[model samples]
Target: MGRGRQKAKHTKIARELKYDTYNVNYSALEKELGHPGDDQYVDKWADQYADDDEELETA
Candidate 1:
């Protein structure tokens, strides 16, 4: 495409992104933000540093 047409298309897309508003799925948003729906998850490394804490306490 021509430079003018290319620039115009880019401007149109930028304007749409700048001015557009859409409905947000809040529950999906919460899940994405790390509020898990259950407590069954466990971190395998959660206790990995626990031994270090005891070393410091004894020293």
Candidate 2:
């Protein structure tokens, strides 16, 4: 194919992809990831390192 034609085809495909809307299935995603729908997820390690981080910041 010619360079101009190839470039035009790429641009058309890119425009179509850019304008496409994706429908996200959150319930299915959560089930696939084994994550409960509860939003109270907490990081245990963050709490353990909180004091050490504050000490470094003061120094």
Candidate 3:
């Protein structure tokens, strides 16, 4: 397709998305936003690499 035609099609789709309204799942939104705490993840190699990271920082 030509450039103008492609741009027009994209603009039409963009307008539809901008104006479209649909039902929102508030429970899912709440669940997604409720968790703010860190997962308390531990890296296996973090202890071994800690010395290397410190040396690089010092240099």
Candidate 4:
């Protein structure tokens, strides 16, 4: 969302999971989730996944 929030962390995770690259191409992860844009969208999707994961774990 805003700056100075460790945004690259999500991108790294996504890359490890084969979601996207530095150039931000929509990998299978983005396609499945219908994510648009480049790195920005990847970051947003990653955050969403993290939030969802937390919710699931808590549930």
The model with the greatest TM-score is 1
Q: Give the per-residue Cα lDDT of candidate 2 at 8.
A: 97
Pairs of residues at least 3 apart in sequence or in different chains that clash in candidate 3: none
Error of 2 at 38 (Å): 14
Q: State model 1's lDDT.
A: 0.84
Give the local distance difference test score of model 2: 0.84
Answer with 2 or 3, whichever has the higher TM-score: 3
Clashes of each: 0, 0, 0, 0
Question: What tens-digit string does per-residue lDDT give for candidate 2 at 1-59?
Answer: 59999999999999989999989999888789885468677676875575777899999
For model 3, the run of ten residues with the poorest summed lDDT: 33-42
Single out the weakest 10-residue window by summed lDDT for candidate 1.
34-43
Model 1: runs farther than 4 Å from truth? 37-41, 44-59
What does candidate 4 score in Cα RMSD to the true structure? 19.5
Task: For residues 1-59, write the lDDT of model 3, one tens digit per residue.
Answer: 59999999999999999999988999999989675568666577886655777789999
Instruction: Specify the poorest-scoring 10-residue window by lDDT in model 4.
Output: 39-48
Error of 2 at 47 (Å): 34
Per-candidate Cα RMSD to the true structure, in Å, reads 4.3, 5.8, 5.7, 19.5
Q: Put the candidates in TM-score order, highest first.
A: 1, 3, 2, 4
TM-score to true structure, per model: 0.55, 0.47, 0.49, 0.23
Cα RMSD of predicted structure 2: 5.8
- Which is the better candidate, 1 or 4, if ranked by TM-score? 1
